[model samples]
Target chain A: MKKTNAGKKYAIFFCQQIDKNQDVNRRSIEKEFGPQIRFFPIPCSGRIEPLHLMRAIESGADKVYVVTCPEGACRYREGNIRARKRLLYTQNLIEEIGLERGMLELIRLKAGNNYTVDKLTRELLG
Target chain B: MAHKYHILTSPTPARFKPITKAGIIAWEEGCLKCARCVKKDCVYKVYEKRSLDSRQMLDSLDTACMDCFRCVQNCPNRLIQKSINPLYKALGDNYWTPEIIENIWNQAENGRVPVSGGGYHGPFSGPGFDAMWTDMSEIVRPTRDGIHGREYISTTVDLGRKLMSLEFDSGGKLISSPPPLVEIPLPVIFDVLPWSPGGKGINLAFLEAARNTRTFAVIHQADFMTDMDEYVPNIILFADDDVLKLSKEMIRRLKIIELPDSGNVMAIQEHLKKINPALVIFIRFRLSRNASVRAAALAKEGAEVIHLTANENGMGKAEDPLFIKDRIRQIHSHLIEAGLRDEVTLIGSGGVAMAEHVAKLVICGADAVAVDIPLLVAMECRVCRRCTEGISCPVDLENIDYAWGASRIRNLISGWHNQLLEVMGAMGIREIRRMRGEMGRAMFFEELEKEIFSGMGIKGLINGK
Candidate 1:
């Protein structure tokens, strides 16, 4: 497939445990999207602070997608929940700072699902 | 084979993006979307390399922009502007002003003296350290260039007691056993920070820099780690009622130890001296109302070094406080009156914000100064104090590479050393020892105002009271 989102930059922050298939999926995504997209694999989504999300936006990313494990299915118990709250906080801060809304999105992986990364990337950009 | 004293420094960039003084504001709403936008045509290419630092959440464009105003002027729709950054304004408190913080940052990044592009546009005079001006009458003389090594100006200072009078046996052979003295090349020593987002990495950075600079770092006895054994000679252990922590071997390895001025401080000093008679002991105390009398008394009581500490703003710790420079004057003159000034070394700390402050403090009476806050600023600490309230450091100071942090601290000291040399060169002083307590070479605001403008009723106006 050809990349269609011209000049649109996207950042994906995902938990390492959330996607066991990230290695394969990342390769395929890199082949398809190239430098237009970036992936950051963190230990847990709970480690994602407002600074990380805001910095991505500030760095000229059109949209930032944080992929977490399914709600309550986190190996660390509340990683996804904390990620959701931090995303909301960041969204509100950008709004107050005169930036557009919906820039920061939190996505939860489907329980027991493989290829969630591919599914989400296509679903968001398609 | 000892080499002449010189501080080696290299360009050590900050790990975090610094908060710039001004940030650009560009609006895309009214952009003509010119074939060649002004942003692309900028000489600095600030827009092309625009990125955000994750550690500080600071935009690179803000710092990279050289304030050339090309973009602001060339924007077709007048949509671009520059404004003072709120973050920069909020960097430090009144005492540690934003200008001082930025100056330290620049000095740390490059080991060069910070020369303002425009020649000296600050106020005539201000508070505490600013109120005193060094006599630079010999600045125009070319042969007195100390920084270029044309003339050897010694910045080395001794950190131990000396004999007032030496006795000799028959045939003029010396009989008195002189006390041990540790000479540091720089008049500046790294003191314990008033506050910091402290960690092993930070403490190690200080020790490493102290080792590289050949100066001392005042480490608390409790913070002394076995890993720091190699740096023991460069470490001045502050044994605050914890003299027991220092083993005989450790005491012997150390060059100096600082003890709080407790009731039995003399007994403790004597005991430490017995363990290592070559050890230099520093007696530390807060500067209070009767600090002059107390300093004289301690010197007569055989204190090796009197470390008089004021608050961070240079105000003495008392209900009615005097500035550290004034306090240093008082204590130094008191020792002189008691004929003990040459016998005891006096180290003044607190409120030393710049290199000039070091020279000014020495002129006011300190043998050398213990610097605290500038070391933190050199490591990109904004003095936000978030760590004090248990918040994670914005700059992530705890995780900084020790080598990078040490280089930054070393670079800062190198810059200060050069500036000190320049000041001394300008003042026609060849050595830092001669500059100490040279009050005639400096013009104090309080003194000058009272001398010239006193009849015109400019007394309180001197400090703008």
Candidate 2:
């Protein structure tokens, strides 16, 4: 049985601070999912600019997601909050250009929760 | 030169998906997955093309679904719904409202005046500039179309002092040489932003836009680089250095320069004139309790221009601060009483966040207005002031391509110029110079309410009597 969903491509931009464990079984997920899921770890979600998201979509992303630390928990203080606003602003821009706005999203990781990303990914794929 | 002033514009697409006003929520619980599921029947194919943003963890269904309500009504489980996005509500602050920021963004993207299909739905009166209304000439004379009409309406304005009386030389030739004047096609000038993360790139963009528009941008002398020499003709150096320290060649190359107002400002002006008489000097002063009297004195002393700047909210720095409009009126009236109104030009800055504020400031007494914040808005700034706090700007404005930034600023200015033209055309004024100090053509809420409602029959209604 296949461990990952087929045919759909997903791009993930996660903040490095959220999953500090470095070896969070991402390789197993990637190995199981193969090229269907791509992970781009960023220093902070605040570094996720509007162009980066647009380029991801323009580069053939079926969907793009930004994973960040929970509000008030960002290592850089307001990184998550700023990321949220930028994501929304980017959504509006894409909608104006005839793109579906739901192609982008911002996910906040629960503090001290190690299994949330995996669970969220599984739920999303399902 | 032809009287034509046209702003060339091109469509510049946004690099990111913009925050939309609303988002849709569709619950999947208790789904029967019927033969003809409501999702399959979505007119917009929102469900058929549904995908998840793995990064943001958002469902594409929310963004793609048009608010037709077909799915909401047809869904057997009634799982579909729409709600206003909280992020949309958080775009801007009290003064730089979200709507205004969005409008500026649209204008910058397309260089078109935002046209709402429906009638005006906003309140008739509110605080600040909204409380005043300009009288339109459409009812009396419908033939004149301001912006798109056959007749050319000029927006050109001169920036310099004018001689009160003409003097002749011994040979019967005019010897009272006119002061050097810089004529800009538009009455608006680019003012340095109060706060921005994008240092040189933003300044370059502003300078480029100012040059393209044939206007001036007030740049701090310290920030002026050697590479920016080509734009010197359109650059107004706000000099902090002593007049004697500035090279004669630098003064010669520049068209206009601004100096901070001080007790010895006249002496400094005279010293600058000796270096380059062609340079138009503008004294920059903060709007305060003594601004009116000070302005009158400066004009009497033969100051070429006076730039009166209020706080960010257009309020003075006094205990009981007057608004920019009131301060300008006071200065204008004081100058008029001193018979020096025609000697100097008044350029008002601060709290000029919108195009309408430009016209209102002019009507109150400014010959021109210097705008700062709207330019930042054009580049999609939310006025979050995170940059001021030494934090990274969410927009990454510092890395912005100068071309893109310049184009956005140009488009924003184009929108403003069109609006100014419309106002002038509707007021039966052909030139912006004529629009200045035309207070009679505009009605202030305070004045109108007092005149019409004061001592009226209705008690407690007029200010509760």
Candidate 3:
């Protein structure tokens, strides 16, 4: 961990149903990634406001990951579609304000049991 | 006891967490794990007390950090860094700059004159009010310090027409009926905001603050609620398109009513005067290329008060717009030339963003100023226009308690009043009336530039333009 950006803070906002895909233990994730890695579970990805995402960065998160359901697979029909539009808007606002690019990411997970929160966190670390 | 006007103020904290100017981006990646870490050396204890407010999604470190930079300097791995907060930078538009918003917020919270530690690092001169400098030539003399002096410096200003001369009968009795006039302790008034979160609470806050300060708040005829009856004395009914909405009782109770300039403006003024001869009516209109001509005509027409307004940026509506300061000067000069300057009151509105702008506008010829956006900013508005776009206000301005909002507004005015006193004292001007259009006590950047540098290029000079 003695390297630049190794201890960077992160926040992951995901749909609550995404946890059903794989057995993701929140305590285990905290034990491995340390307290800097934060989690926020929402009922649906579309419920997230652009203010929430911008506020995450303002709250000292180096990067934010918004995990949404796959296209057309959202239980709320167009929830994932709405989330994508909001994420795009938030990204543009960040860039327009001269903030670092790529600080925000929108991840659309496929409808399968192959994904886990722990695995997703490790993949982002790379 | 002789009535001495003073605004009582107390510290009123912000209803919501403010967007701070700078944020520390400290990454803990390369931890040497020293026996005594740099985070522990923070004298402000900002690092140890670091926590995120989930509701606001704000970092405590950003607001609590004194910016001593000790932690940044002592970090062995060079991990800590300070950068301008993007949210702070995006608070307001180009006209209402982030710095101005921050200053207003600080003043509202503490009701204190803002004093930055560092010397001024801003440009010497820019556009509009920045292009003029108030002469503080008497500053070295201790007696001129009005803020802590025994001498009384009056910021009071009258808000209606004045009689140029009083005629006497042969028996030495007054023969003319004196025109009614209203006076306020300060030269500032609460004007209608261009847009807001839109709630009764917001309007109540403005009215309450106006009542508490013994000043007038401009309320449109449409927004007049029955609950505002108690504040009638402090409310100036802005008669928009329709004057029939006003009842005689309401007119009699009110001290002033503003009428939008129309084709039959004088007839309407006369009609309103018939209802309450003691009432003062102010003629309101937008500033344009013909603003001076229109203002002089209005003065000649016996308009008690002529309120000239510019846009939010102090720019008039024209193909080539002039700033409010220049427009006020033009209208003032025009009225003086026509021998009508002493008859009417000129209340300048728009783009008065700071306390110094208040004094500067008066120096440029305005008798008083009407403020709009800064009052909203006192209520923690970021000028983000979210409320205007039908988006929820980030600060929850719609749900604010009117009493708290009123206190914050009062605090802001108190801060401005104190600063006004300091500026007047420095200029050795005891009364605000004398400060009006006193161009001899001020300096303009354009005139000084032309006087100093205009001759350089004409004569044999090095690379003169």
Candidate 4:
């Protein structure tokens, strides 16, 4: 739902759920980079299959990352935890298959934390 | 010089109803002397007061069924129409469905094959042999020289394992597994009938015809793999046995041995490797979406001969024939893409109807083909929908002359061969074998209909695409 900017490398920030904040994220991200980070919001990060992430890379994505809630804080409760496992499994598969594993990353943020977003963004962009 | 008319013609093979016309039988016990039965009750008006002869009743049964049931409906004491015909057994059989029987009857009547001048008219495509059609865009161009300059293309094919080369060792005599190949002058080959019309004469006729044409007839392994299998080395007998059991002294005389679908072609290749590795092991696989994959795998596994077939009627799936051909082409292209196209031989069958069909199939990438029902059709058949109704056969197969049938079949194959040449010449290709899978020499009807026809000829097909 949200559009991001091109201040940095092409990266996907997959959100756990799409909401009014998606517009907020799109505006702020675009305001920063115009059209760089492409945010794909799903119903829950748990629904993302590893194959989907692999396919995204195969189709020319430089990097992909999932944004879930901080531990034990997601409204869907166990969904964020599932997303972490899926992400880890996918990263391992890519490593075993001799692809760049660092390209696939996961970052967690509390429900109402702007400071965490900036910090995570700083880490991902770095 | 002349034209033909279509009257009461069917789109598929014409078959006859298994039941012959009804015969009049007199019940001596119930006749009040039946004066009314002779006067107005006979539908065919064949009833007369004369002494009834059982032989005459049988001879006159010729599909003239009144079915009024007048005698049954009007019998004051209920008598007549109770003729017990032994031939009633002719109607029901696995292959000879009531519909198949009717098609045979139509063929029997004219002593000629039934045909539809129009395009196909069935429900959906069928399984196996009924799903494909050969592409024929190059059909009309005449590059061959005949009387003035029309060339004649031959439909003959060889049925033996081909080899890259052979070598010897040990005492330096030779350690070669020279595969036996059969060379037929025509592309048509006799196949095991869909129905087992277990008549020695019919099989003999088929064999005799194939022999005469320098081609081979295929009999199921079930036929001669037993007691009566002493000789007849010219006939290609297909069996499911391991090649080790097939080591007979007359190995050189065998034309071909169609391998059964055992999923393990390696054992077959290994067995043949003992004798002549070139012993053609024709792998018969049915047509399907995965046929290309299957074909590619077979070629990879060292299959000598690969056969892709639909069903008896030329279809084996519920998809379009073009779609099926595409599937086969993909497999062929996959082999080529994988740089293994020359390793195995390809044969396709089913849904190959016209002479143009042969060339088209070759273009789709088959070295040769195996035809089924069209053989019977060319010998005279209509695909009627009746064979199992406890009735009699309208067509008297017992009385057909085999020689006449063979000539008609020969004419048909010969006609097709010339057409193949016609298409090949149009594309400026001299050798047909080289034209296999050459898409550059063809135009899919759909493609042409879409791109070129949007502005050009033919009033009906313009879709403004």
| Candidate of highest DockQ | 1
How does model 3 do on interface RMSD, in angstroms?
A: 17.3
TM-scores for chain A, candidates in order?
Answer: 0.88, 0.86, 0.88, 0.71
- Predictions ranked by TM-score, top down? 3, 1, 2, 4
Query: lDDT per residue, candidate 1, B1-465, as tens digits?
Result: 235777788899987778788866434334677723334668988877776567343457888888988877777777666767655776778899889999999999998998868688778899899899899774455456567766677888998899988999998999998999989898888998888877888889999999999999999888888898888878999997478867898888888999999889999999998998989999999998899888888998999999989878888786636899998998898889889999999999998989999999999899999999899899999876656655556578989888899999999999999899888888888779999999999998988878776556555575434
lDDT for each residue of candidate 2 in B42-138, tens digit (9 for 90 to 100): 7788778666554344455656666677776787776555666544565666667767777888888888877776698777787777778987875
After aligning candidate 4 to the native by TM-score, how far in Å is the CA of B90 from where it should be? 20
lDDT against the true structure, each candidate: 0.82, 0.78, 0.83, 0.55
Clash number for each model:
0, 23, 1, 75
Every model's Cα RMSD, please?
12.7, 10.7, 12.1, 28.4
Cα distance off (Å), candidate 2, residue B171: 5.3
| Interface RMSD measured for model 4 | 38.2
Please tell me which predicted candidate would have the highest lDDT against the true structure. 3
lDDT of 3: 0.83
Over B1-465, each residue of candidate 3 has an lDDT whose tens digit, in order, gives 226677788889986767788776533435576623334678877866766667555557778787788777787776666766555666687789888899999998988899877899788888888899998864464455356768788889998889988899999999888899898999999999989988888999999999889899999999999999999989999999489878898888989999999989999999989999999999999999998999988898899999999888998886537899998998999899999998999999999999999999999899999999999999989887756656556678988999999999999999999999988988888889999999888999999998787767566665464
Candidate DockQ values, in order, are: 0.06, 0.04, 0.05, 0.00
Which scores higher on TM-score, 3 or 4?
Answer: 3
How close to the true structure is residue B330 of candidate 4, measured as C-alpha lDDT? 66
